[model samples]
Target: MATTVRRTVLTLPAATVGPPNPLPALRPLDETHSLDERARQGLPRDMARQIGYEPLRTLLPVRVLDGYGRERTPTRLDAIVIENERLRATVLPGLGGRIHSLHHKPAGRELLYRNPVFQPADFALNGAWFSGGIEWNIGATGHTTLSCAPLHAALVPAPDGGEMVRLWEWERLRDLPFQVDLWLPADSDFLHVGVRIRNPHERPAPVYWWSNIAVEEHESTRVIAPADEAWHFGYERSLRRVPVPDFQGADRTYPLRSEYPADYFYDVPAEARKWIASLDEGGRGLVQTSTDILRGRKLFLWGSGRGGRRWQDWLTEPGTTGYAEIQAGLARTQLEHIRLDGGEEFSWLESYGALAADAATVHGDDWSAARAEVGSRLSEALPRAAVDAAYEAWRPYADAEPAETLATGSGWGALEVLREGHKLPGTPFDESTLGEEQAPWRELLRTGVFPEPRRVTPPGPSLVAPHWRDMLETAPADPLAEYHLGVAQWHAGDLAQAVRSWERGLELAPSRWPLLRCLAVADQQGGNAERAAERYAEAFDDLCEERRDDGDSWTAATVALGREAIAALLAVRRTAEARDVWSRLRPSVLERGRFRLIDAQLLLAEGRAAEARAVFDAGFEVADLREGAEILGEVWSALTDEPLPDAYDYRMRPQS
Candidate 1:
C-alpha cells in the first residue's frame, strides 16, 4: 500500500480547555529545576552554559489557561492520520500537534501510549496540558505554552514522493518559527518525523526542543539507552550524575521500580547513536531514534508510589495502564537551552517504530549487553546512515508549498509575519489566519492608531514582542492601548513604567477590571500585599457588576478573578471580606477543586479548622495541581496532627 495522509475525527470524553485568563501573567517565571553549586560541580562547559541561560522572565504574549475544569463531555477532536503499509500515525494538530497514536499493523500493536481521554490538566507553561502520546515540547524548560493550543497543519510533498502533514507555528516565547513534518515511506515500519526550528530574528535566540514520547509502563518494562551515566533530576530540585540502569538501590530503567517521579537524562557519548527504547517482558515495544543533532535522550518515570499512581489516575481514567516518557532534545538536559544564531536554523530527523529482540538478552542483568542488543536491532531496522540520508532528502522539500490546509493555529504568527514581512517560504502564516484577536493589532500596524472598542468589555490578547510593544508605545493613548502597553512594559521588565501605564488606564477606564487586576499584580510583586488585596477586591467587584449576563467567558473571568481576590483578602486576615468575595462566586465556580482548596484555606484562616478538615474529607482533587506543589501536605498538617491521605499525597520529592 502507498503511504497516505488524511483527515479524521477522534471522539473522546474531554474537558473543555476553556478561554484564557483575562489578566496578563505578571508573576515571575516558575522555575521548576534548580541545581546547587555542588550539584553542578562536574558539569561540562556547554551544559553549564546552557543551564539558566536566557530563561523567560514571564509568560507574556500568552495568557494563562486555567478556565478548564474536571467535568468532561464527549468531544470530537480534529486529527490528521499518516499511514504506510506497516504503520499508522495519528496526529492531533489542535493539541500541540501531538501524535495521538502510532500503530504497528504488522504486529497489531500500538507503538505509543494512546490516551483514551482528552483531559486538560494545568501542566503546561501556560497551563492546560494532557498526557500520553508524543508531544512536541518547545519554548522553555517546561511543556510548551501551545500544549492545549493548536498548530497550523497542512499537506505538503514528502521526501519519499508521498504526502506529509506539516505542523508549523510561531513560538512566541523566544520569537522563533518552527515546523514538524511527519511522513511515512511506503513499505517502512517506522514513522519518520522531521523538525526544523528557524530563528528569523536578527539576534541570537535560546532554543529548547524536546520530543516527548510516552509509552505504556508495565512491571517488566525497561527503558534502554546507549549511555552508562545519566544526570538524575528529581522533584527535590537537585541534579546529580549517576550510573544508569542501576541507580540508587534498584534498576532505574524500570519505571515501576522507582518511588517518585524523576528524570534521567542519559549522557550518551558523542559518537553513540541517540536512541531510547521502552520494551515489555517479551522485548516487544517502541523505540525512538533521531539524527545526531537531537543529542539528548531521557527517561521520565512516574514510579510505583502512591503519589505516582495517583498522578497516573489523574491524567487519565482510573484503572488504565500508566506510562513513562522517553524524550529526545537538542541539549544534554531539558534544563539547558542551546543557542540558535540569527538567520540560522536547526533541523533533525527522528524515527519511531516497534522493536522485538531476544527477551532474555533485553531483560538481562548486563545492562551493556541489553543496550547493545537493542542497538543492533535498531540498526538492522533503520540505520543511522539511513536517518541522515532521510534528513538530507527532506531538507529540500522543507521549503515546498503546502498543497492543502487542514487546520489553523493562532493568528500571532500571521501578525508577526505581517509586521516584519517575513518571507517564510514553506510555513506561511497567511493573513487569512488572523482573526478577531489580531484585528486591533493588525489595524494598528496598518494605521498609526490602536483602535479602542466602543463597548466596555474584557480586553483582547496582548502582544509583548519588541515590534508590537514599540507600535503600542507610539499608538494613540486609549484605555485598551494603555492596558496592552502596560502588559508589554511589564513583560520587558519595566516595572515602574508598567505600573504607571496601568494606573493611567485605570484613570481613563475606572470600571476596567483587567487594568485593576494588572495593578493588583504589580502591587503583589512590589510586596504591597494589602494594597494588592484592596485592588483585587475592587477588581472582582467591578467585574461582577459589569458582567451581569453570566456568560461562559465572563463567568470564567469572574471565577478566576474572584479566586485571586479571596486569596488576597485571606492573606491579610480579612476573613469577612474574603467570605464576601467567596459568596459572590457562582455555585459552579465554588464547587471546583481549586476553589474548594481555596475554601479550605479560607476556613483555616477564619479559625474553623474543623470545617477546613471537612473540606478535605469530602475529597476533591485539584485537577491542575502543580508538578511539585506541597500545598496539600501543608494544609493537612495545619488542620490536624494526622498523616496526609494517600489520595492527596502528590509530593514528588521525599519529605525531610
Candidate 2:
C-alpha cells in the first residue's frame, strides 16, 4: 500500500470547449401542449411507431418531482472542474453531474470524450439519453431513468485533503439513495471515485448501477479487458463464450466490421478484477477499474457500417462521430444478481485515469503490464489510514436528505446554495424495519426469459441450461430461475422438460401468475391448445384470487398479468373467459393509457370493431397523446385489412 500523503484539493472552472450543437434527434420536444395533444398531432412525417403500445410515461413510475422532459439548457449552465497537478476533470453539475471531460496534462489528451453540445436522444426508457462522458445509471434499466435529467451534486471536504465533487439522488421508484464522490488526488494521475448506495426504504427493492463511460470511437479504438475468455451474444442472439481477442477466427476490435453486429458480453471470471479501457489507436485512452461492487464490465459497439454511422449521427452532432460505452456494474454480470437488504449501505471504490500502452496487444489478464505502463506509482493502493479517513468523512452525506434548495433543482444547483452557508435537512436512516433478505426472484425477473430470436432458435437451453442449473444449485427454490429453466427448455423443443420446470416453479409459488402464463404459452406453442386453455384459465383464476381485493395496491404487473390471461384465453377462443378477466381489471385498464390499448384489443377480438375504433378515438383525451395515438394506430391496423396511414407503416420507422 502506498503511504498516505494528504494534499489540498482545488476546484476550478470548466476548461472544455463550447456547448456543442445539439443533434435533431437529441433535441427536446416542443411541449407547448400535453403529450396527449402532441401525440394526436402525430409524429413528424419521418417518424413511425411499431405494433405495440408506446408507454404513456416514457419511463414507468419515475418520480416526476416537477414535470417530464424538463431539461436545462447546457450552454447556460456552469461547470465545475476538479484537478490535481497531474490531471484535470470537468464535471458538469447540470449534466447528471457527470465527469464531462478528463484531461491528462502530460499527454495533453482528453481522457474522456467531451461532447461539443449537450445532446439527448430518445434512447432511454425515460425518453431522453445523452452521449459522451460518464453517466451514472442507477435504480432502473436503460440508463438510470434520469440520464439526461439533472441530479443533486455538491462539493465534499475530503479528509485526505483533496476537494471532492459529490452527486446524490433519491430514486423514488425504488426508495433508494445513491451518492458518488469523485476526486483527482494531488500528484496522482488516477481519478478516485467512492460510491454509496443506500436502501432507505423499509422493504428491500431491486436496484442496479452502471457507470457508462464513453470515449472517442475511431478505427484505432480497441476495447481491452483482463480476461482471456469472453462471452458474447451475437446478432443471432446466441450467447457464445469465446476467446477474448479472437472469437471464432475473427478479431472483435472496436469500430469492428465483423458480422457480430453489437457486443454485450460479460461472462467474466469470478475472481477477476474487472477493468475495461476504450483505447485510442495510439495506445492511450480512458481506463476504469473498480472493486467487487462493480463486477460486470461491458463494451457496446455501434458497428462500422452505414447503420452504425446513422446511430452515431443520432447521438452526436454533424461531423462529430458517435462513441461506444465501456460500462462497469456492481453485479455478477449485469443487473439483478445481487440485492440490497433494507437499510443496507453498499459502498465501493473505483479508480479512473489515463493509460498509454507500449503495444495495442492489451488483451489477457495482464493488468500488471498496463498498470506498470501508467506509472507504477498510480496503481499503488492507498494507505489504509487515508482510505479509512476519506470513507468516514464522506459517509454522512450519503444519508443527507435533499432540501428544497432550488425547488426541484438537479445537479449542483442546490449544493451551490449550500456552499453559501445554507444547510440542507437530512433525516437519519433508521434500521429498525430493515429486512435481512432482498426481493426473491429479482434477478430472474430483471433478466427476463431467453432472448427471442427472429428466425431459427440458437442451440436452445442445452447450450445455456448448465448456467440455469448452476443458478438452481445456488438457490434451490428460486421461482424465477425455475421459470427461466422452463423457457430454456421450451426453446430447445423439449416440451416435457419445460413442463416439469414450470411445474416446479408453480410448486414453489403456487400463486405466481407469470409462471402459469408462461406454462400456458409453452403449451400453446407446443400444439397442445386444450392444455394451454386449461393453464390459461388457471392463471386467470390465480391472478383474480391474488388481487381479489379491489383495494389491493395496483401496479403495472397486475395490469400486465390481467392482459396476459385475457390474451391467452382468447388465443384458445375462450372469449367468455377473456371477457371475465377484463371485467375484473377494467378499472386498472382504464387508468393507464397503455393498458387501455389492450382493452381495445379485447373489444376487437369480441368483434366490436366500431367500439374499438371509438376507444382509439378517445385517445385525444389521453395525457400522452403521441404514444396513445401510436397504440391507436396499431389497434386500428388489426381491426381492418386497410393499409396504415403513410406515417404508421412499419417500413417507414427509424431504427433506434
Candidate 3:
C-alpha cells in the first residue's frame, strides 16, 4: 500500500491540562545538573562553552502548567496517522506532536513503548508531561515546555510523492520557529522524520533539540551504541566519563542494572554512524538513526530500584511494563545548547524502524562485537548513505507550504508573525488564529499605550521578549503597564529596575496581587525571605478577597499563589500563618495531591508528626511530583524509623 496520512481519535484516560499559572516565572532556571570542577575537567571545549552559554534565566513568555490534577477521565485526543504497507505511526498533534505509537506490520509488533494511558506528570520544564512513544524535546535542558501543549498541524508534500504531516510552532522560550515533518516512504519499514529549527531574528539564538524515543525495557533488554565511553550523569548532579557497557561493577547497557535513574550520553566518534537501539533477549526492537548533523545519542534509564519502579507506575497505569529512552540530539549532552546564527536554520532527518539481529551476538560478552552486529543489521536495513540521501531529498520539501490545515495551535505564533512580519515560508502562523489571549497585546501593538482592563481581574500573560519589552518601556505607565513592564525587566535580568517597576505599580494600585506576587519573587530571589513571605501573604489575601466570585481562572491563581504563600510562611517557621493560608484554599484545591503533600508538611511544621504520618499512611500521590525530587522520602524518614514504602519511594538518587 502507498503511504497515506489521515485524522483519527485516540481515547485514553487523560487528565485535563488545566489553566496556566497567573504568576510570571521569575525564579532562576533549574540548574540541577550543574557540574562540579572535577566532573568538568576533561570535557571538550565546545561542550563546556555551550553548557554555560546563554542558559535561560527563567521561563518567561511561557507560563507554568501546574494546574492539572490526578483525576484522569476518558479523553479523546486528536491524532494524525501516517501509514505505509510495512508500518503505521500515530501522532498526537495536540500533545507536542508526540508519536504515540509505531507498529511494524511484518513483525506484528510495536516498535515503540505505546503508553496505555495519558497521565500528566510534573516532568516537563513548565509541567504536565506524559510518558512513552517519541517526544520532540526542544527549548532547553529538560523536557519542552510544550510537552502537553498544542502545535499547528497541517498536511504537506512528502519527498516520496506521498502526503506528510507537518507539526510547526513558534517556540516562545527562545524566540525560534521550528517544524517537524513526518512521512513514510512506500514499501519501507522505517518512518522518516525531518526537523528544522529556524532563527528568524537578527541576533544569534541558543538552540536545543532532542528526539526522545521510549522503547520497552525488560530484564534482558540491552541498549547498543557505537561508542566505547559515555558521559554518565546520575541524579546526584554529577557527570563523569565512564567505560561503556561495564560501569560501576555492572553492565550499564542493560537499563535495569542500575539502581537509580541516570543518563549515559554515548561519546559517538565523529567518524562513526549515529544510531542507538534497545533490543530484548530475542534481539528484536526499535532502532533510531539520523543524518550526521543530529549527532548525540543517549540512554536514559529508570532502573530496577523501588523508586524507579514507583515512578514508572506513576507515569503510566500499574502492571504495565516500564521503558527506557533512546534519545538523539544536536549536542553531545542535553546540558549543552548549540548556537544558531542570525537568519540561519538547523535541519536534519531521523528514521525509526524495527531491527532484528542474532540474539547471542547482541547479548554477547564482547561489547564491540555486540555493537558491530547491531550496526551491520542496521546497515542492511537502512544504510547511512540512504539516510543522508533522504535528508538531502527532504531539504527541498521542508520549504514546501502546507496543503491543508489539520489542527490549530496557540495564537502566540500568529501574534509574533503579525508583530514582526516574519516571512516563514513553510510554516505560516495565520492571523485568523489569534484569539482573546492575544487581543490585549494586539491592541498594544496597534496603539502605543498598554490598555488597562476595566475590571479588577488578574493581569493577563506578560510578554518578555526584547521587542515587547521595548514597546512596554515606551507605553504609558499605568498600573497594568507597570506590572507587565516589571515582568519584562525581570526577564531581561534587570532586577533593580524590575523591582522599581513593581513598586511603582504597587504605589499606583496598592491592592494589585499580581504586582505583590512579582515583588515577592524578587524579594525571595534577593534572599529577603521574611519580606518575601510577607508579600506572598499579602498577595494571597488580596487575591482571595478580589476573586470571591471564584471563577476558574481566578481560583487557579488563588491556589497557585496560596501554595507559594504557605511555603514561604513555613520557611520562616510561621506554622500558624501557613495553616491560615492553607485554610483559605478552596476545598477542591485542598483535595489535590499536591495540596495534600503540603498539608503533611504543614502538619509536621506544627509539631504534629503523628498527624503528618497519618497523612502518608492514608496514601496520596503527589500527582505533580517532580522527577528526582526526594521530598516524600525525606518526610518519611523524619516521621518514622522505617524503610520508605515502595509506593512512596520515588527518589532517583542514592541515599546519603
Q: Which prediction has the highest lDDT against the true structure?
A: 3
Q: Please provide, for model 1 over 538-637, each residue's C-alpha lDDT reduced to its tens digit, 9 standing for 90 to 100.
A: 9888898898577767887887788888888888888899999998888977888998999899899989999999999999988778767789999999
> What lDDT does candidate 3 reach at residue 372?
97
**TM-score for candidate 3:** 0.98
lDDT of 3 at 571: 92
Root-mean-square deviation of candidate 2: 16.9
| Model 1 clashes, total count | 0
lDDT of 3 by residue, 387-424 (tens): 99999999999989999999989999999999999999
Tens-place lDDT digits, model 2, residues 1-656: 22121223223221222121111011122221122333423332221121011212122124211111212244455566677777777766555667778888888888776777655554554444567888887755455556655555555555355456666665543545667777666676677788877664446656677888888877767777666665454333233456665565655655464432455555566675557777775767777776665777777776665445544654555598568778888653332324577756678777788776655344333554643443322244333244445456556544444322211223222222222222223422222211211112223223534333233211111212233344443444455556656654554456688678878888876446657777776676678887877776786677666654433233334554565567777777788787887777656345555456666778888888889877766652222222112454566778776754432321212223
Give the Å shift of residue 208 in candidate 1.
Answer: 0.4
Which whole-number lDDT from 0 to 100 does residue 119 have in model 2?
A: 50
What's model 1's lDDT at 509? 84
Q: How accurate is candidate 3 locally (lDDT)?
A: 0.91
Per-candidate local distance difference test: 0.89, 0.54, 0.91
Off by over 4 Å in 1: 28-31, 34-42
Per-candidate TM-score against the hidden true structure = 0.98, 0.53, 0.98
lDDT of 2 at 435: 23
The list of candidate 3 runs beyond 4 A from truth reads 28-31, 36-39
